[model samples]
Target: MRAVIQRVSHASVTVDNEITGSIGAGLVVLIGIHEDDDEEDAAYIVGKTTNLRIFSDDDGKFDLSALDTSAELLVISQFTLYGDTRRGRRPSFSHAMPPEPASDLFNRTLRLFEQTGLKVQTGRFQTHMEVSIHNDGPVTILIDSADRHRTRRG
Candidate 1:
């Protein structure tokens, strides 16, 4: 599993001209799943995302976790995160998990978040989605279950 987490003042997902999910003063999470993903991956990601200390403190230091501050989450499935174009003009999605498995993991992942007591909103899976975001501090981070490297202070 992989995710691009963006701290946003507001974000929303629209499908077929209808708003599917929306949030305010929270994080917009773009999620990707691979073939090898499982419950452990979902649990790991859920723990990391909610506990990441990205928000500001009273002294303006980035020291508050989303959980501590009660930030909402807007999750959107994005298979494109695995796009690989190193070999051809067209990007290949060979590294991405097949839709059936990926969507299953995606749904499970979101459920884990909700189970953790965080308010979670979700985009329609496998649908054409348009996202609108007001990125706070333009703060963005890439998270991967395999990659130990973490972006931003979170």
Candidate 2:
């Protein structure tokens, strides 16, 4: 599983002109499930997303985790994260997990986020939706379950 986590002042997802999910002062998480991903991968991502210290402290240092700030989360299923464009103009999604199992993992991941006690919102899966994000600090972090060390703070 891979996730693009962006700190946001606010974010929302709309489908068919209807708002499906929205959040304030939090992170917008775009998650992609790999073909080999499972519950463990989902768990790893959930832990990192909630605990990563991307927020700033009073001294303007990156020392506050989302959990510390009680930040909300906007989770979205983003299979396109796995798009392989090495070959040609067209991006191949062969590395992305199939929709059926992928959706299951996505839902499970969302549930894990919700279990964190912080407010959690989500985009509609497999739907044509528009997302609005107001990025905070323009801080963005990429996380991959396969690359555990990359997400760790020294």
The candidate that wins on lDDT is: 2
Show where candidate 2 strays beyond 4 Å.
149-154
RMSD of each predicted structure: 3.0, 2.1
Tens digit of per-residue lDDT, candidate 1, span 10-114: 999999999989999999989988778888888888888988999999998989988999999999999999888899699898998998988888999999999
Question: For each candidate, what is the lDDT?
Answer: 0.89, 0.95
Worst-scoring 10-residue span by lDDT in model 2: 145-154
What are the runs in model 1 whose C-alpha is more than 4 Å off? Answer: 148-154
**Structural similarity to truth (TM-score) of each candidate:** 0.93, 0.95
Note the residue pairs that clash in candidate 1.
none
Tens digit per residue, CA lDDT, model 2, 99-143: 999999999999989889999998889888899999999999999
